[model samples]
Target: MKLVRKTIFWLHLGIGLLAGVLVLMMSVTGVLMAFERQIVEKADGFHITATGNPLGPEAHLDGLRTAKQPPSSLGFERDATRPVVYQFGKEKAVFSDPYTGKSLGNGNTAVRGFFKFILSWHRWLGREGASQATGKAIIGIGNLMFLFLLVTGVFLWFPKRWTRSGVKAITLLQKRLKGRARDWNWHNVFGFWAAIPLLVIVISGTVISQPWATTLVFHLAGETPPVQGERKKPAPFTLPESLAGLDAAFATVKSSNPDWQSIQLQLPFAKTATFIVADSHRGRPDLRRTITVDLATSGIVKSEGFDDLGPGRQTRTWIRWLHTGEAGGLPGQTIAGLAATASAVLVWTGFALSFRRFFKKRRAAA
Candidate 1:
């Protein structure tokens, strides 16, 4: 029993130490992303969203082909409330906007910087030349280490037996007396309560990094695979195009959802571009729902809500939401953020304890 206890403790402490630096970086950066939307809204004075009006995915593609600025790839999207949004990426340029085809400007905006930095740190540790797979592997390994730490930590905190005295010893907060026990109590108590959230976050993080996990989820949940089509050269939309006329497109879609208070239009990158719009409900900034429209045909193509996502997608989505606390909205995010912040403290204090132990062992040897 003593040997098992010591083994778990040593393993927990060693793993924590090994992954401490990376975990701290991920936690700090994760905290930044938790309030990113609110922060950008206050700083930029604008919230880029989409319209729920249905759009022709093919027409959007056609418009792009004619524009001469056709993207290498495109993705349809919508915010909490808005019209359809199109994302075009290439070797040199990446454009994001509504299907009505408004160019919001380049990708170098200040608000985008926050997202870029947080993502880079979380995924790559900001290390240049590191492949995404490598970054995810490192993060995945770290998560597994944390899971192990959680298990061992629970064992360490468990009392030797179920007697009343042992139970009191296990449950009592004697940290008030100070010294090693105090730090140990804080680490164990906080760890015990925070275990579920921490484990969830790490598990979600692993999914992000592991393709096998994603594939397994798709098979298990029986989700439809993501739509993927070929990309061709750009062909700009013809004049009289008015880039598909923003006002008419907006009015047509807005009539469908009167509950929406604001709408943002994005221009197509090419003639094939679709009219994308987005809307929000209750004034919150999450645009998990949206509608799309085809510029040429002006027909509905896709309508969906994040809440309505399929099981396969939701598994990962919910995990990400749990990680960022966005799944439950503001309250969920706040709770998760606090947990991450606590984890940072744990890492710091854990290191201090390990250091103290190391020095004590050396002193004893002398």
Candidate 2:
């Protein structure tokens, strides 16, 4: 048992030292992202109250055009407790309101700004070339290292356990210890408690960051590349056939899903394209609603219930939802926020421990 602890101890210490900066970067950035909604609200002068009624995407676009500034692209998005917001580029274009048009005043986050800075530092170290790639690879590799840290931390915590006394010892914070043991104990206790959620966070995070890993996930979940369109310079807006008579399509979908909080209309970008509408109530996965209308006939071409998503698409949705804690509604989002906050604490403690050890070694050598 001592032999196992000694070997795993060195392994954990070494990797923790190697990946410390990356973990700290990720943790600090994650903490910032946790309060993203709040930051946006404060920075942009946006109100997050319920709209009670939202206009169709086309209507909103027309409204923007009336204002003499149509967005290059319009997106409908949700943040914690807010109705779907119309976004143009990086900020909220407007909240969903019935009568008057009011801009949300650019919903940028102070927290997110700091978060982005940390993320850049973490991902690129603000450098270039193969060095940038090295940063990403190191982060990816650090995720794996974290998993090891969690496991070994658990074993070390339970040197010969399965008792109330041992468990209590694990739970207690060791603030008084002065050297390697202090770092070792802190790593063991916090790492054990934080194992499951941090693992989920990191794994889901890695899947998002690594494109090839994401593609592999798609392949595993049975997703093939969607059929591609031949390259063609598309015509300027010619009263899109698909959207020409969306009144009936909108009525049909609304009639079917009366509980929807908001329905977003996505106009087709080019010839042979299809217009799309997706609805959700509180952004629940099960409530995912979509319909595609054929441009030629102005008839519904395809519709998808949330259940209809293939495993690959489902996997994609799950990872995104999981990361943001949108999978579980308000509860999930709250949990994710808490996790991010806790991760920041973990990073701080981890850094203190590692640095303390480094100083001790220096002192001993001197």
Candidate 3:
């Protein structure tokens, strides 16, 4: 038992040191993005009137046509009073009047751009083109190591004998802890509290980062997994010739989900329009629904919600929402943010302790 603990201790310490920097980058960025949804929502002003006739996407786009670049997509906010927002790409966005379809200039561009920048670093280390793939690969490997550290860390945290002092050290904050002792206590305390949420965040991120993790989700659920990266991404900014489908698509989706809190149309220059509605922004997966409307015939095509997904696919979907803490809503995001903050501190203390051990050993030998 002692031998096993020693082996795990060394492994945990070694892996944590190697992956500590990558973990720090992800954790700090995660903390920054935790309240992103709510902040962006408030910044853009999404207020849906309980009673009012809101204009369609075409009405909103009417004013934006004279812009330097045509909007790639147009979406309806939760309420009629709010302006409809359109995006040029991931970063640039413009809001238009719901009544006149004229451009209301732009909505929260800095905040949106800031979040996008943080997200790029978090997922791909802000690398672009072919190098982004390299960034993703490194991050994925680092994530795996972090997961290992988390598992072994819990084992190492448990004491051989649970005395009152030992329990307090693990579960309580010791006073006036200095230098190496301070680092040790901080590492254990932050790790002990953040362990659960960090596990969820890392595990879900693992599922996202690795294709095998995704396949495993399906295999465990006894369902056939879809082929990875099979779908060819269509040109993002392709503007449709006709804005006629937007109204029909929005109306059909609204009828399907009368109690829907928000809806956004993924503008595709196609015979059908896809509308995604949610009970809250970036949260509540169960209350979320995707409805497709046939633009040509102005008929309801198909409506699918969380309940409609198969168990395997549902679990797969849950992995994504869980990673972003969207499945559990605001409380989930808050926990994730706090855990991420704890992770940054963990890395700091871990490095501090490691440096102390090495220097202390050298000094003693000398």
Candidate 4:
């Protein structure tokens, strides 16, 4: 039994040392992203007055079509104070007033850039193209190792005999301790308390990073995983002289859900493409709704709510919310942030201990 415990301890230490830097980068980025949505919204400075009645979706599209370069999509803000936004190409966006369809300059590029930079590092280690794929693979593997470290760390943190002193040593930090002893106590205590939430965060992250794990999630949920690249091709048709269909699709979705927090209308990529409307509920991404409309007929093709999702898709959605700590609102975000911060500390302390042990052994050999 003692030998088994020793093996687990050494395995934990070795894995921690190997993956510590990547884990630390991920942890720090996770901490930053905990409040990213809120921070970005505030930084965007997209405010408008609610005095005048807002124009209908069609009218807004008509206004946006007059831009020097037509936008590929339109975003409607549910908040009356916020202006409508038009997305051009992939990353550029323009803001406009909902009341009069008047231009309000560009969307918040600085905030968008900041978040994009952070997300690139968080998701792909700031790499691009083939390197990005390699980065994601590394992050996925590191997340699994991180989960393993958490489990082994808990085992290592268990009290030897369950005595009061032993329990305290594992559960509480001793403030009076200095240098290595302080770090040791802090690492153990923080790891013990943070094990559960950290487990959840890492598991969800792993599931998202690995395609096989995603399939496993669906299988466990009693549903068939969707096959990749199996979308039905749109029926061939002629392009309309105007974007009247886009407005009609938006109106259809908005009329059904009057309380929608925001709506994004994706323009047809091809003449046969369907117009897609994403109606997101305020602060509740899981509850966001989707609608598809035929490009030729301006008729509703399909509309889906959160409850309409299959078990597999629903589970994946919930996993995303859980991973980001948004499912539980502010308190959940706070917990996730603390867990990430603690994880960073754990990496730091683990390296410190390993180096100390290495030097001590070298001196002893000398």
Candidate 5:
């Protein structure tokens, strides 16, 4: 039993040290991203009062199509006050009033840049192209290590005997401890409390980074994973004489869900394409309602609500919400943010204790 405990301790220490920097970066960036949407909204002055007399989707489509280079997609803002967003070829997007077809200009660049930087480092270690791919692979592997660390950390936190005193010693931080002892207590106490949320966050993160994990999720849910590029292609057809179908399709979805908070329309690139509408209510993105319309016929191809999704897909959506704490709204975000902050502390304390022990061993040898 003693040897087993020692082995687990060494394994925990080794893995933690190996993945410390990557985990630290992820935790710090996660803390920043926990409230990112709110910050960006504030920075961009996003609030707009809706005018009941808004124009139809066709006008917005025309306005975007007539631009210097036509946008590949158009996102209709469900909020009557907000401008519809037109996304050009990757990375370029502009907002225009849905009622007037007038440009509202791009949003605050500085704010966008700030979030972009955070996201890049959070996912790709601030690398680009091939290096970014490599960084992502590293981060994914490190996340696995981090997940293992969480499990072993709890095991190491367990006291020799299960008693009221033993429980209190591990659960509460001792104020009187100094140096190494203080760091050890801080690491264990925080680890014990932060374990569950961090585990959820890490597992969700791994699911996102690994395709096999996603497949496993689907298998567990008793559903087959969707194959890539398997969407049935629409029969070849020409552009409609008038883009009235776009407006008609938008109305169909809006009339169905009158209380939808926002609806983003993705204009199809092919002559035979489907208009993909992403709907959400009350700022809860995890509860997205998707409606697909055939461009050729302007007919509703499919309308899927959150509840209508198969277990595999539904689990995927929930995993994303869990990772970002969007599932629980503001309170969820607060908990996820706090967990990330505690994780940073755990990394710091772990490093401090490891280094102190290392130096002490060397001193004793001398």
Candidate 6:
């Protein structure tokens, strides 16, 4: 039993040494992005010139005629004070006055850009293009290693006898300790408290990162995963020259969900039909619905609420919310953010302890 425990400790130490930097980077970035949408909205300054009965998508599309790529989505919140958002290809977007079609430009483009930049590093290791695949692979390994560290750290931190002194060291943090002892205590304390949420964040992330993990999630839930690219996509919808169809379609969808906080029309650059997602709260799966509208008929083609999802897809959707801690609202985000912060501390202290032991061994030999 002693030998097994010793082996687990060495494995944990070695993996930490190998992947500590990656974990540290992810942890720090995660904390930074915990309140991203709210920060961006605050930065946007909530400019409202006028609202209610705003112009249609075609007018916005015409306004953006010079854009290199057509926007994929556009929408307004129920709040007249908020600017309309036009999401272009990839990370590009423009916020504009809903009443005048005037460009708001996100109030602070730099702040928006900053979060976009951080998000790139957090998800893709700051790698782009074909190299993003390589970065993701490396990040996946780091995630696995980080997850293992949390598990093993627990075993090593558990006091064999559960004495009062052991409980004090593990639970009650000491501020005066120095050197390796201090680092050891910090690492254990942070790791112990942060384990469950870190596990949640990491495991949800792993399911997101790996296709097999995604499939396994479905399998574990006793459902077969949907085949990729198997569903036949509807033919693209061409917009009418009048563009009146779009306004009518949006109105038809809006009339049904009068209390929607925001309703975003997703074009997907399709020819005749588009999807509008109406939600009372951002990231709240329960309060959301997707409506497919036909541009030609100005009719609802289909509507799907959260309850309409299959068990497999529903669980999959929640994975994203859980990973971001939006599932439990603000309190969940607080816990997840704090856990990520602690994870950062754990990595730093673990590395410090490892290096102290390494140098101490070399000095003794000399």
In angstroms, how far off is 111's CA in candidate 5? 1.8
Q: What is the lDDT of residue 134 in candidate 6?
A: 87
TM-score of every candidate: 0.70, 0.74, 0.89, 0.87, 0.86, 0.89
Model 6 clash count equals 6
Instruction: Order the candidate numbers by lDDT, best to worst.
Output: 6, 3, 4, 5, 1, 2
Report the lDDT tens digits of candidate 5 across residue range 1-366: 999999999999999999999999999999999998778667766555565577766777665443455566677665565667777655777877666667777877788788889999999889987798788888899999999999988888888999997788778999999998899889988998899999999999999988789999999999999875444644433334577566666677778667666666654533333444444533354556677766567676777676787989889878978998877778889999999999999999999999998987899899
Stretches off by above 4 angstroms in model 4 are 66-69, 88-90, 229-239, 243-252, 269-286, 292-301, 361-366
Error of 6 at 278 (Å): 3.5
| Candidate 6 overall lDDT versus native | 0.82
Q: For candidate 6, lDDT tens digit of each residue in 1-366?
A: 999999999999899899999999999999999988788778777647664577767677678666655566787788778777887645677788778888876468899889888888988999988898788888888888988988898889888988889888987679999988888888878878888999999999998877788999898888899886544644534433455567777777778787778888876544455555656566688788888887778778788898988788889999999998988878888999999999999989987888788898899899
lDDT of 4 by residue, 1-366 (tens): 899999999999999999999999999999988998788778777768786678765687565443455566677777788888787765687788888888887756787788788888889989987798898998999999999999999888877798998889878889898878888998999898889999999999998899899999999999999886544744433333565555555566777776667777765443333333334433455667667766567666677777888999888888888998877888889999999999999999999889888987799899
lDDT of each: 0.61, 0.60, 0.81, 0.80, 0.79, 0.82
* lDDT score, candidate 3, position 61: 56
Q: After superposing candidate 2 on the true structure, give the runs of residues whose Cα lies further than 4 Å from its correct spot.
A: 47-58, 64-86, 89-97, 102-105, 108-135, 174-186, 219-244, 269-283, 294-299, 354-366
Clashing pairs in 2: none
Model 4 has an lDDT value of: 0.80
Model 1 TM-score relative to the real fold: 0.70
* Weakest 10 consecutive residues of candidate 1 by summed lDDT: 269-278
In candidate 4, where is summed lDDT lowest over 10 consecutive residues? 269-278
Structural RMSD, model 5 = 3.6
* Candidate 3 local lDDT, residue 298: 71
Backbone clashes, each candidate: 63, 0, 5, 0, 0, 6
Better of 3 and 5 by lDDT: 3
lDDT of 3 by residue, 72-171 (tens): 6676766657777786656577776666555576767777888988999998999987798888999899899999989999989997788998878877
